[model samples]
Target: MSAVLASVAGAALNIGTNPLAIAGLVPIVAAGLTFLRYLRFDPEDHPVSVQKLLPEYDFVIIGGGSAGAVVASRLSEIANWTVLLLEAGPDENEVTDVPSLLGYLQLSNMDWMYQTSPPTDSQYCLAMIGDRCNWPRGKVLGGSSVLNAMVYARGNKRDYDAWEAQGNPGWSYKDILPYFRKSEDNRNPYLARTDYHNSGGYLTVQEVPWRTPLAVAFLQAGKELGYDVRDCNGEKQTGFMITQTTMRRGHRCSTAKAFLRPVRHRENLHIALNSQATKIIIDRRTKRALGVKFVRSGRNKVVRAKREVILSAGAIGSPQLLMLSGIGPKEHLESLNIPVISDLKVGYNLQDHVGLGGFTFIIDDPITFTRNRYQSINVVMEYLLREKGPMTSQGVEGLAFVNTKYAPKDGLWPDVQFHFAASSINSDSDQIRKITGMRDSVYNTVYKPLGDAETWSLLPLLLRPKSTGRISLKSSNPFVYPDINPNYFTHKEDILTLIEGIRIGLNVSDTPSFKRFNSRPHKMPFPSCEQYEFDTDEYWECSIRHFTFTIYHPTSTCKMGPENDGDAVVNPRLKIYGLENLRVIDASIMPNIVSGNTNAPVIMIGEKGADLIKEDWLGQHFRKT
Candidate 1:
């Protein structure tokens, strides 16, 4: 049994070096893969052949990601309007469907594998490889949704209201709540019945079907600390609850699955996978986006968009595409010898939820998830046959939104978000370390010694960061990767806020609920911070700087605001400020970063952006709400 379990673990991690162990699990592995294949786990729902490319389409959307998928699907509902979605990567496969393996998906071929270019004086990400952090954006059809842990959070009500206050009309919580509901098909009976949530939508939102005892204990601990255990996505944002995921029947339901698959039969919608859009063919004199130039199958192709061209290429890709198409800052474009078109701030105002990664709490019991404990034939079989097992878990089981001292006292808005993991970073046999770009010395000294011990962790993420970053063009070449400078912890207040968050997390772990299992902070101090006494604010601050982590929620590069806002790249209607018939409809257009995981809000943006487009072309009567 132990040998079989080892084989299963080896096969699952794809690091099985033992020929004998691999040979023993070949049959089981083969059967599971074949079963998933039979279920059509691949995102081949749409039959889009290269030969089917037409001379022109009414709308050319560059990217088949979270927002692009929704935009393409919704626009194609009109029979007369032709929509083309060009994705840089291929369709998702069975490997991406398994929720438990979310971490492994990063740094793989499916990920864009972006690395941040931290300034020399930056104190954060010090322990990472080359003093840089890995930014794993999905390169698949579903984009980052295919790579994320499937946390379905819409952020605080004030987040959208703030956007409206920032001169973006029709973006308040009340105004956009319908759009959130329009795309949600909530599986939870209670939430589905609420006015805030609805049923019979394209996206499936529900609690993770399976969780460990530690996850339940996490909620109890939150309650002990005077936090509510109610729905975090519903009436109140400041509370604790089991994580709601974008999943269906224990499988990851990416945007491509939810939005694109249903409309695959639409003759007006065409998806071009592995088509990298190099530039937006714009009429300079008219300032109109005419078409898109993309390369597919080693061939260059330009397709005309009769009406509009939309960039739904996410925060990173959208700004990069804009800059490459000569729509960035005048000075920066001139430095690269590219003629400036719009001369707007394309990649400024970048923000992400930065957190501390190695804050682990040890427990006496063996209840926490570890690769060795759950990687067995029975577990695999249960997931395959019944879609119920540890494999269904997305690792993140519980969540809490709490207000720090820095947060405003008038509202329920939280400045800190806690992600409760059933297992610690050390539980995955260095997979987290590899994905996060942790140095060998740090992982070997701090986490490696833990060796799959029963442990849990609460990752305290700064929900509202004061420090902003930017994405800049590396060269005029569209194929060249852009430089991402997250510039985390640049503000002293940001560090202070995170320190308070860490204190709250520690307080939760010290509660009676967690104390029942004899839970205690892991004693190993980070290598660079060993000089300071452990558990002190000084020590923790140093630890945070060394282990600074990105929650993968980069946004606000092409900020949406009124025309007078100097930093605004897109107008309130999501149209490019200085151009006609061009708009950015992804997370890039966020005026400010939302308070939680960005996937749900990004999908909402797509739904609302689609309506905005409809109103512009088909008149105001075409609006849904």
Candidate 2:
């Protein structure tokens, strides 16, 4: 009887909606979970805990995140080198491995949950809690890679070429392509056979195993708009395709899983979990970073590094740590009564990918994903048994890169990127709204009314935003979060570019392929923008200010450039100017943010940084592929 009921419930879920499906499969799923619990299937291998810390290591890397994990893993390959990785949070568990639960992880303990400070004169994030945008960075072992949407997008080739053009050597697309390929193990057969992608590497890149029909229509709509359905990561920068994710067999394969777990048994590598790095201990007279000061288990501790102390604490944390260690602007450090070590710009030139949210297209079909329908017991069973279902979907199913009118006329680069989500803001029943820090009033007025209706949305992201922000020290304390002012849309060109992106998104919705499902724009006007006519330029711009969205790609706080560049904190070799034995190996070192998602590019940065270290210390001949 149980087997028969389970089969019927599974069939009902395949059709996307059956109220009784959940009730019927509950018992079967409960029993299956109980049976599985007895098997003790642990997906993650527990790293051996360090009961006592050695006084010194050959290398100490801060923040065991995306880049830190890779650096620690690769450096430990040298048998004689002792490496210590300090992570402020605990390890990732089975729950975090589920791709569909990414939204739920944002405000949870796994995330740093940093919120952007309210702009003094701007209207951005006006509808959010305290008018601040939530900036979620991963605090766990893999850092943001464990918390991100898992999109593995590598930006345009020209983006890196532009970096080399800025007086930085060996950062051009051709020079860095090997590092990108060295870390990627493309699981897609067709993509793997290409010259651009490789087959065997630590990070697994593949298309998500499951997606809604809305993803299919999004690609078709791109073709109807005269765009090619080609690989956006290969050959060209402007096109549409199914998003490739950093997933393996339908589970999130974060940097911790990819680089750290496999090498957990290495005796030279030591990881200190739940350890917060308070400061980089730089010798005041010599200006050399010698070690790290941290607090672990309510006890303050200090560990020295014989060779180098690498900072991979991410965009926000890296700047904050540097500033806390008196490695910031001279005036700011003196104001806090901290002694200045190197008065270089530590947190300027902050950039992120901003997008306009709440652009929903209501569709008549039941193919779009909904929380209640897809989160049923039958769906859980399908995932647990076959590793295939809506649980495998990364929410963002398809992506399209388009060049807006504001972009360069060269036609090879894209200024705006579109993220096609099978589920919209309201489709998850206010889960996304609450996590994004949206106000109750705004949610009730704009999104709540949509209820359980099937809907899809195209989040038009400003790929290369001209507006730059800053990260500053809130106080001398290391535990206090930094003041992040993205200063979004402060530049006039940013708002204009975003508005053009919206117009293009609307055009994509109007394509013939989208019309197959009777898809149409949700034409409700925001209560704040009711004065303007709906769907007009004025109305859309008003909506954009009220519902500004961030794609969580903050970068370039500690920029890399030549010696003459005043804004540069690090040189072309990624070493902090005027300081010795210290380097930053994360997204924070980017001179400019990439054209698309930042996770893959950051992992690539890690690979290149590891090689750079080898070249500096072990000579160029010791560099790995």
Candidate 3:
């Protein structure tokens, strides 16, 4: 029995256990790869033939994105236990390798390619940026991390403490900081090794060493605009500061590069690429999660779970899976002709942070990312030869925080964030983010130059939004995406706060330091904001309601909390309500969204969860029973 448990623990990458357990995994690796019958553990082996399906695993984790990969890698570290990671997308290749094409990956094969259902209100139609805005999710091996700009951040302490207060004990900032530290390999060679961060950790966290002179001037410009220059993720979230990225030297350090690549050697771990999880397998009469059903090469395959089935499928995918599994609102499932297993809040209380576009600016030097036809073999060769200049930059290298004149007054964290990217606003527009548009075409660059001036984007992000949204089912089909309603400006305060940010962006552009770079404020001639007599406070409010796009921060769906949380879908330990032997380890469990980028926090959750599971076993051993 001890040998069996020892083997199980060694297979998990993040599970902290004694050395003996690791040694026990040797045979499982041999048995799994050689012949499954060697150890009679056929359940852990992948099928060599297309006709055979491995019916069971100790753990089956859905979605191999940031959260899923971390959890699956850690859980499988236990020696003999079987683990299967199901991903809907393929691997990250050179397109993801090039930093210049980073923004273009959004709607590509790597992205889930979701969008908001057109609003019910007519004003929303008049308010769009161009056409439908693109929502990019990770479609490849590392999920979104494979394609993200690689901004590494830990949001405000208040955001976590708020979770504990709302019935999620041990989820406060103090409780989770150790996990964040545990996963970071702070590349700053000069930093201390004691408590701030760990050196041997799998995740890479570093600072962009080279910033254009314009970047520094932009920082000073914000300071001149009355915003404090402080660390965006430090003691205060307010003020302007450089963004800490997940890059090493000049390359993007996505999760696939960090955690997944190193651990693929572990024979116990297996990743199924192009495998899309369509639903969780639940015991209808028992009301317990049993396994998962997925599609591989257009064929439906059911994989059973012996111990647990975990959903790391992300905000949109997780809830969608639950609903399809007949574990959602009974009425909604029945309407689609699906038998109900258990009625729980699968898709409810969706929340997201959104902000308006910032003041536009053009560099006087004419040396932005958009220069030189956006594709110069000479430039690419320069980048490959020497890791210097714009090629090393991920465009937006600066960040700042500020208090909106009407934001929350009690905290040190600001309600606003300032993002400084190298490219102009129009360059990152709806047209460019589209995955499969006629990029490199003639009309886009030459014939359709709006206003005949080039402008890069600087965004003022509202950290704490009063706006609330919902995620509902589109149909009974598991393959179909959900209806995402961000309902921006539902709370009038969000619109007011954004308008105030626009005011600040205008102020910063007008500063003398910004004048040196000739970074003047420029707005697209959107008739909605100017025409139809839409200049008053009411018109501005109406425009905001229709014009906003998600900043890619969606959370609070399936939120963890105590009973009657009103918005919660899971317990404090991230266990989905009304279920056993199942857990959710992703942004979906975020009771309230963090104040900064969600990647760091998602990784932290995985770190903490490994300990929680191990600790549970330890506590059981120490019990009087």
Candidate 4:
């Protein structure tokens, strides 16, 4: 039976695993003999009937992700309201289930794995300054939240207040604070004392266990630097602190794991994985959004929406959906022969937080994270046996907030967001790129290793950089990648901001308390950060332009603005301007990118969006939009 099971498993038609590497297809073969059903996000509820409204659903959601999942879960709870979700990738995988491998995202089939069409001359050249533009979006059930590094830092108050100043009413930090509290299930004793985080939320937001030497060293160094070590998400996002993460008892706590999974069994909810929506069906005469047309396993289907079509497909996917449905710039759509339904600038005003890195370090202790192979095996055994120990590390466990501005502090959030990883990974994820290459060509070559042997990185991601990017349609094909120009550092000020982050990293490493732990980076690459001698400030400036990369924080492609704004695509309520019964609820609605990794904020958007949806529905007394 064991041998039979193994053979069946290997026979499964995986998106990437070797077809001929059928070492043990018998497990899958055995499951086939037993006529097994696919594992579902909802496995316990009475079966949802798909017959009554086959052509139309109550709500047709595009992208089964952080926000879409919650939107479906909450909307369906009202009873007898049918909901449909469209995901471009498969739902079940051991890849998404394993927590530690979360950061290794550019792997086989977990990511949409995209890169920008290399920039042209008219748009200004990054090569003239030296930077390659690349982007990644999770093409799977959980969206980017499924593929992102699990750091859960939220942007401080200043960012939200700034958004309100930009005429986005009800979005100021004070105004939106309730929304933050509503989504977080903080378990930390220290964080619980704060009025900021609410106690009874669906998401389990907590700190990762510190198992490696690097974690302790980073904290010691930060304390020595005089930046009051405090929780970054507590009363203030202003102090140096060990960063919190989206982990539940040492495992990744994605939105699917929290709000969506448990509530999926509601009788009205329906999740359609491996489904790609091509267009939003808007009834021209009625002026109401009817539904969406999507493909599933090579079969096309049009699911009507009696309620609304919610787009929670992240920054790129949301705008792409909008533009493909003819809700974007009129001239651009016209050029692509897409008859325009609404000319609302659906894919402009793109914004992302890009990082310019600087690294120095190596292990000296006999206690390196990469010790003996037997030690690693033992750690994995303990983790599988009890779900504890070094195997639980979320890679980067510490962070330092810095006062990089030359002027007096604003009592606002710090200008810089620093990340500390326990074991050194010089490049993005060397391990995942290797696997992705085996399955697909275009997606595999996205990584370029930028690490020093035996060294960990203290990455300083620029959270509030003034630079912004734009998203445009490519030939009107849903399968084609969009022309993403994340004009990194388009504003010269962004250059200075990242330099400050590097300066803060250096200052923290030079502190006395850190000296006690020998936390200073190993001194082999003395006068470090690329040996080309970026010694002068001008040389440093060149180094900055040349070596920066996306921290995978892309947002604002479908930016929200006051209704009449020329460049805005969606309204503050997250509804696409000039389109009825269709709304976008995701990072794409961010008027500006936040100050940290976006996974937590994305989930926060879902939680808040669910409430907004309920509020709107209740205000209208459950009537159709």
Writing each residue's lDDT as its tens digit, candidate 2 over 444-562 gives: 88888887888899899999888899999889988888899998988878888888889889888898888988888998877898899977778888888888899799999999999
lDDT of each: 0.87, 0.87, 0.67, 0.65
* Residue 161 alpha-carbon offset, candidate 3, angstroms: 0.5
**467-585 per-residue lDDT for model 4 (tens digits):** 77788888798888788877766677777777777777767656664444455553222122335443345544554554455667888888878976787777777777877888889
Off by over 4 Å in 4: 1-53, 120-133, 371-375, 406-408, 426-429, 432-453, 516-535, 620-625
How far does residue 85 in candidate 2 sit from its true spot (Å)? Answer: 0.4
Compared with the true structure, model 1 gives a TM-score of 0.95
Worst 10 residues of 4 by lDDT: 438-447
TM-score per candidate, chains pooled: 0.95, 0.95, 0.84, 0.84
Ten contiguous residues with the weakest lDDT in model 2: 30-39
Q: Give the higher-lDDT candidate: 2 or 3.
A: 2
**Which residue runs of candidate 2 sit more than 4 Å off their true CA positions?**
1-44
**CA lDDT for candidate 2:** 0.87
Model 1 pairs whose backbones collide: none
What's model 2's TM-score? 0.95
